[model samples]
Target: MHKLTEIIKYSYNLNLLYVEDNDEVRNSTMIILREFFKNITVAENGQEGYERFTEQKFDLIMTDINMPKLGGLEMISKIRETDNEVLILVLSAYNEPNYFMESIKLGVEGYLLKPINMEQFLVVLNKVIQKVQLKEKSRTYMSLLGQYQEVTDNSLIVSKTDPTGKITYVNDEFCKISEFSKEELIGSNHNIIRDPENPKEFYEEMWESLKGKKQIWKGTIRNKSKSGKSYYVQATIKAILDADGNIVEYIALRSDITDIMNQQKQLEDLIDFSIKPILALIEIVDYNNLSKFYGHKEISHIETVFANTLLQSVPNKKLFDTVYTLSHGRFAFAKDANNQDIDEIIDNVKKALHNVNSSSFEIDGKVFDISIRVSLSYGDDILENCTYGLQKIKKGHSDFFIANGLAQIEKKQAQSNLNTLEMVHTAIKDSKIISYFQPIVDNKTKEIVKYESLVRLITPTNKILTPYFFLDVAKKGRFYSQITQIVFNNSFDALSKTTKDISINLSALDIEKENVSNMIFDLLEKHKKDASRIVFELLEDENVKDMNVVKNFISRAKKYGVRIAIDDFGVGYSNFVRLLDYQPDILKIDASLIKDILTNDYSLSIVKTIITFAKSQNIEVVGEFVENEEIYLLLKELGVDYSQGYFFGKPEPL
Candidate 1:
């Protein structure tokens, strides 16, 4: 009884279609049918049964042989034309051999006598159920296999070989990467593409792992393509085993690493022969602006013309060992300084650049005036020092500067950066990275509405250092995310203790990092109730590369009722178009603009324009650096929504 109950429970999930013309017979069978199958569709005739089959899928069908308007045998014949796999059984009163022969020809699983015997019905239904279970399992396995094949074929170079290491299958990616057709690759030995540069020992170790130990082998390999060009792959090879644990075949998956390998080799070569102790870098002035105005192709032509003119101007090419093109319209001429007169080379380079600048460059019949800056430095870190000199020249009126003086300053700065980085590490380890809240007030009521969380690092001596002292160094050391996390956690803790809303700062860099963004969203989900009181102040110091990322983040944040504020609205490429895209809730005027708003008309005019724009968009404006009553009152009169500065309260622990 327990065994039969288990069988019936298994059949409960299967849908069955039962057709019988007699209403009395159908009602009598329904009692037993409902016990075996929970989902049973009853059809009065063969035509109705065929319609039900067409409307929906059924795992099993049982029909009486004789019926009006299409007999059961004819319906079975029609169904078999489309589907040969559906399980069918005949329950008929006719005991003629022809009926049995017709049922056999129609592919019925069983034929029961006139009045069905319950034992005989159960025995035959069990066989049909077993077949259904097997088909379902097979279908599921094939679906999973197809999905795996799709992913592997799209993303990787996949190939399979027999136990004897003869290639039997290769995906399209493998053939494409190797520049070989499937016909050319199949049945070929795996060694056909192997580079001779890889020693015999390497192949021995790989095969030993696959054939002897039946373990996976992973390595970087250099293989030659059909064109005899070398390529690199990071490969993983594993042996497929039979049930008896004997090797059946081997499958290999590889990712092309040719570019990465080539880059490493180029770096190695550069280090070996290209670097020199003394270097001079010549850069075109305002190259970024030029590129922006002219576009990349035109600027590239201009760069080529400039480079050719420089080469022509320099008579003694031997003066520099190698001329390497650096990025951003800069070229470095490097040479050893052991016996070379660095000043003479610098003077000659300066003269060459002067000649190049005097010449006019024409593109598409449009003439352009060009200027150049030159920096000369002698040190182990020649490139870095020369770059520093170029930046200093961009600030001043000098066209040429020897970077020896700047190198001393750079050495001190490097030491300072190292010290700051060490301090950041220590602060993080000691849990001294903390946040201080500065009150932002409602200008009309002079009531505190929210606070901005500022990050501060406490030194071992308990001295509080602002981001200016360590943030850039921390970013270089990859500690910026850790610091942002700490400040975020501390700010949230502060939010829990107070009712006033809290704002946290996020830079474009922070938004670009996946882990940081994930951490933020996870916290928002965890603290659902407090999300409405939270605000994110986007710092505009760095340009955001992908507006979509920021837009998506803002969209998700708004879903949790969190508001966004554009920090430092009047500076660093902040424009109206960005304003529309971000649709921020508040705009904070930069301190530089707000500090001199009282005396400087230009600053006042800019502030007025910003406030006017914000008002038009219905965005609140916060005046930062409101040091005294005069600035606060002026801002209030101008209809600014909020005020934040030392006048309200300096940033301090809650």
Candidate 2:
């Protein structure tokens, strides 16, 4: 038969990838693709091809189901996740019906038999092109949907109310902000949301503006949600006038400025009842080299002395305000910027501090001068406000300008809610942080498959301290390791006490450092039963470096007969599409997807697609946060390998 090279050249030019473990088949396949296509990428196994896919976008992916390092089904599934539009045609030598059905489930455009098909390959490409085009359009639509959602879900509550003060329509975003659904709000008056904090005059002026057909009226109103959470909404309302010069409806756009108002109040407090005198960032600047640079001792001393000097000279300083030491030996202080000339004040203070550093008392009969740099600011302000304007004073000093670095962390509010988090944190430290386990059941057997360790902090003072209370703080510091240890130790201890397999979380940090993993391994070796019964559900975002820390830990754990699974894939920072690339033994769909899986067909479809993809890779799948029987059944029908949620049982301590 004539070479298919002429046929492909005359039709469309493209690069083709052929991946299979068999050396004979690999070479033969490469020759065939090269005959038709000028560029043919070949890999010995699916794993290498999968890595190649990440490095480059391929027009077509052709692989056999059975391969050495990784399987074709897995690579296909991973490819389908990100670039569904790409043509994925499986060329397994075996005509296994299950493999074909599985391929079809993952949106595999086409499948071809082995012994190579030049004629059949061209035919399959035509079919795949159509599916790929359709898939591309669908992808674009989904992307557009996401953007539309972001716009509609602006933090502000935008609503339209009639001149009669009756609420008429509200956007889903507004409903979410108000915690009231469209059904609960359509006919209800805006008064339903008016909190007691909002004065009666607020409504009086709002109506006056609506009646007069005013162009705009701006005001702040306290609104109460269905959950009774009070929110301050900054709103701008306008008139929608008819041709008759009569106001028919109103247009209102609101932003929930609760956090804004809180910050404003804090700034106002800093300005008024000013006590602490410093709000500045101090950095050691030698420009090129900062290691053991000038001002090392001074910077350290500033941490302890700045407060004392500011208080001694101006003794009204408040001790409660915090100081932060950032990465790269940068120190910062934030407080009231009311009275003092910060530059001149810091200048004099810098001179005095310089003196302290310059004169070193006899130390081992040798004198050494301490060199340091001090940079000060009134407040560590937001980037938008401080950086927007051209202010020379803000960038004080020539060599060591104020390192006005923007911070993303939410600073502890001066007063309220601080103790709530602290008390909760303390409660957890004192053996709280309640943990429970829910049985991961088998899909086919419906049997209690495994128990996944979970945690909640129960305070010593008869209060339930939730993960939200301390997790963010815990993640910010070195506390993460100890926290992970607690979870693992308790989980292992609980498992040893019970007769069941247990899965525990390994903080991404723990795996990266391997401190906790090695510790656990040592303990498990001692326990004898600990290693065999453990499953580590790693977060999809678990940092993977050159060592592939998470993968290494998984491999090490697997050597001990333990299983590795990716947990909460697709939520937070994790790109779950890549999670499929790892092809863990088990994949747990995040609770966010399962939350509205009942009503949200998109979420259900994702669960179904993930399940199909996982099964084809010889991976089991689990659905988390199934709140009710409806969610459970929905995931079960979708063929999710396991289901864990309140519908079956809440996480309970053994």
Candidate 3:
């Protein structure tokens, strides 16, 4: 009513302590408090309130000052000694100057008159809530900023040199990159890392560029580490000036670019031998789309198949030395063959790729075919030419070879993927990824029975992105495992506090990874007693190559009283015998089968068969995507135990 929208939302999440001596007043105020805060701790007097405060944390506090057995001021004094940030609101009957001064000195949030009027109380409460919210937001912002800063600092080689070019300071990253200890670097000349590869004129030009305090010198520098190993860095070096506008010191920030340089050299080596090196860039087609349907491990397996095909097709090991994968969905290789013979080689490679493309990848029992497109370049600069060809492929010229005119694309898709991966890493590092829950209701009783936990990426832009959008890139970047761990820990911890069961989906690839598997088992063990409330749903599409691994995981998980469910039961292999062997507690009929179940007899038949089979095995059946009352009622008649869909409720944050 007061248009206090921000404060109201913040209050719903915060915990508050209200301390008062009078029972009637406390009860009356608590009725209003319950409408705002989710958790409210009440105490009879200041001493008891202080004890409660010590045991737990609260975002805000409200207390009456004139209470017996230790007044609010004395208790608050004790609290302020240990905790200065918790917002405190004091209620008092007196308007005494001394009381106001003492309260202000103790940093109390507000002083309100006793026999509190509802309208006036809400106004003061709103102000205090705003303060609490602002402080909380500030803390969260600083924490995430700190995490990003730490990552950035750890990655870049940082160093400072005095005007005379002697090293004044160096970060651990600088020492690490240079393979030198801090002591070895601090007093050393900056030229200690200079390499012979750079000409004398290059140093002269750089010094001239830095003659002005603000002029930034940027270049690729070849430097030798302490071990005498040569490396290259893309560096930005500039002077730090003093009040007099004179250069007092210089600072440099650089990133290692040795791999790219090595790749270029490898290309050059092939060309100088008169072998007529050709660069071929292979990209996994629809890799992001595939990741939505599959997992990272499966994607890796598919890429391996593509590589093997390339080697087999080319057969001339001397011509095609090694196939290097740059990132997920992208690969590069060089062949020592001239343009005259390149056509025939391309035909052979295409044939091989076609053969592999005909076959399908089986992940979590689900089978799907993957295809790759190739771009070839015979330009003088291998890296540049290859990247140009890659750009062509990205622009819908995939599966073809190019021999000329290499123009750079404005923004490379691979660069975009890299940026997304960085954001994901930052989110995970800051604990910003979170779980959203959707209700699963009993079909017959029409009562919510459980929830399905879905993971979301909270982007730096404050936009919420679903798994299908970014999960593929994350999986390719080897970040899927970390995300899985975050979702598991947060979801299971939340489930442990409630009686309602919740289901979490896990990829077979996730289960196959020893580290991720162990983390899941550890969480299960931690919530062992409440394990019955946890359900692990494995999609039926993925092929479990190692049945024993899945069996072992299921057995151990079941031992903790957790239940297993076969998700999307009608998709992929859909093998009943295999399902029987896994003996999942719940069979979630695929949405594709249920979406058409009402109008398509074939879909209905499949659903009936799945439900009948599940019943025979004493497994409960859940029908997904039951959109309308007709489907809901039909599912109830078909003996479906539970149903989840937009009809019930969309997935939401808790």
Candidate 4:
């Protein structure tokens, strides 16, 4: 009982895997383990235990040594091949020299003799638990240290020095850029590459900060290379302190910005042209500092090569083609052009730039692959529009735009959408979005067969608004999924109240997103008894880009006895191929085909063809927008299985 208290206090959060071949021992031990551990997984033998270890993460593993299929020593050895950190304990009936030595060789934390002494077992278990706590602490520290090392190695010139200012460490980046070997840099003062541009007071202030052992000191510094070349670095230096809080060393991280400084005027000169310039802003996506993978000189040369490619590939170069380096990993191009020829020129440039960006280059037997995001603008305000276009692309939208009157109107609409989106979000949060039911009836019997659930938003003044007023705004922002969920819950609640079947609409985007799709499955499970009466009304005109996701959703829903119906079947990309692929249980013929069926023979023949084909596949056809007795009687005479519109009943609050 005393050991149990200690175990619960120290090891209650840990997950353990217990492997024992004896069923009686495993069951009894598991019951005891369950008292202490938050989670415990039991396996019959070493082989099964090893499989579980591969599938899940465990804090500790305890196994009997002489288990069948695989022994404790063998499993531990296999585990050590990949992970040597997990604590392992072995229980054995034999305390022989061979078993002890093999266990030691496999790095088992503890070897306990079986027919257990509970007190001694607790002592060893506590010791192993302490080690586990220490390992976890070290792992967190190591993770933080690794992150710092990655940033320093990939993007900065790094160096370290002793408190007395003698160099102690210099990374390869510092060595390559300074034209000094590691051996030559060590033990030398940091002044080896110091340029004479800064006044003496600059050095005085730096020294004062270092002597006071302040936190980080940052400034731009000029330095000279071995070949008498000058460069600039944005440097940050910090004191590294020991456990006693005394400074032991100083570490510095620097970014070389000499090329960026040199190229600023070139970019300004290119942008000073009077012609209507078409600007293309090219941004590097996978930039981890090219200098880390290549020497500074080689990186500079590669940028020059890329600039030349841009100059050559842009269409109609003779009509004012110019390239400039905006900054590290970004470039801008300007071309003088007439308005009529701008679109074609931009298209050719995009194709050429895409080819360049997609290809990889080899430098010094190492491969450098590049990916880029390109944005384009064609107008007098080229630079501003280019920036706007780039922001759009970064937000995962279209990358190219013409800064015309239409674009300004779209910008206003987007801003207006933001205000409307807040209202939609509030409606969802406050449960103001409600479902309205519209009935679909049997064409011959005229009895209600199913009700389609439509969403309505209640305004602050208590006026009700339909989906057409707000759904587009919901899709444009992040509230579409939330709105879908609200509609789903309201529809399901209505389904629970009545025995009538219900149909709810879903768009292609809802099916495309896994989270929304999973929410749908959860809702189905919540109403399992009435799932058969629920029909998913998908618009036939909506584009199904990911057919596999759609197919999987259908197959899973069908397993739960839910029905599928394609709405608006005669409009936009609808055809028999989609019908053959999905094989839905109901086809709701589009309103366009039915509204004009009496006057238009083409519409009549199409409806006839749809009904004929649906009959062949055992799929019921529903005629939509049936407004009058003549159209209703014609649909009934035409053998339509269902009808819905004003003729049946308008959508109303349920």
lDDT of 4 by residue, 277-341 (tens): 57677776655444445544556667777676666755566644566765557787666664558
Sum up the clashes in candidate 1: 0
Maximum-TM-score candidate: 1
Q: What is the model-wide C-alpha lDDT for candidate 1?
A: 0.81
Rank by TM-score, descending? Answer: 1, 4, 3, 2
Model 1, 380-451: lDDT tens digits are 555666889998998999988888667768789889888888899999999999899999999989999999
Query: Model 3 clash pairs?
Result: 363-542, 363-543, 364-541, 364-542, 364-543, 365-541, 365-542, 365-543, 366-541, 366-542
Candidate 3 lDDT over 1-654, as tens digits, reads 355565567687888988999988888878777878888999999999999999999988899888989899999999999999898888877756567657767887666666665545666677676666678789887876765556546666788999999999998878887988989888889889888777999888898879732579999889998888999887889988775457989989776767657765665666677557667777778775554433333455666665655566554455565776545466667666754587776666666567656666554575656677777766466556666776666666446657355543333667788898998999988877999998999877889889999999888878899998789899787688788888888788877556789899987656766678889888878877788899999875445667777788888888888899988887532243456457799988899989999888757866775676567667899989978889999999989999999999988885
Report clash pairs, candidate 1: none
lDDT top scorer: 1
Number of backbone-clashing residue pairs for each candidate, in the order shown? 0, 10, 10, 0
- By how many angstroms RMSD does model 3 differ from the true structure? 26.9
What tens digits encode model 2's per-residue C-alpha lDDT throughout 215-252? 48887777888888998766778888774456778878
Global fold similarity of model 1 (TM-score): 0.49
Q: Give Cα distance to truth, residue 142, candidate 2, Å.
A: 34
lDDT of 3 at 195: 86
TM-score of 2: 0.42
The C-alpha lDDT values of all candidates are 0.81, 0.64, 0.77, 0.78
Q: How well does candidate 3 match the true structure in TM-score terms?
A: 0.45
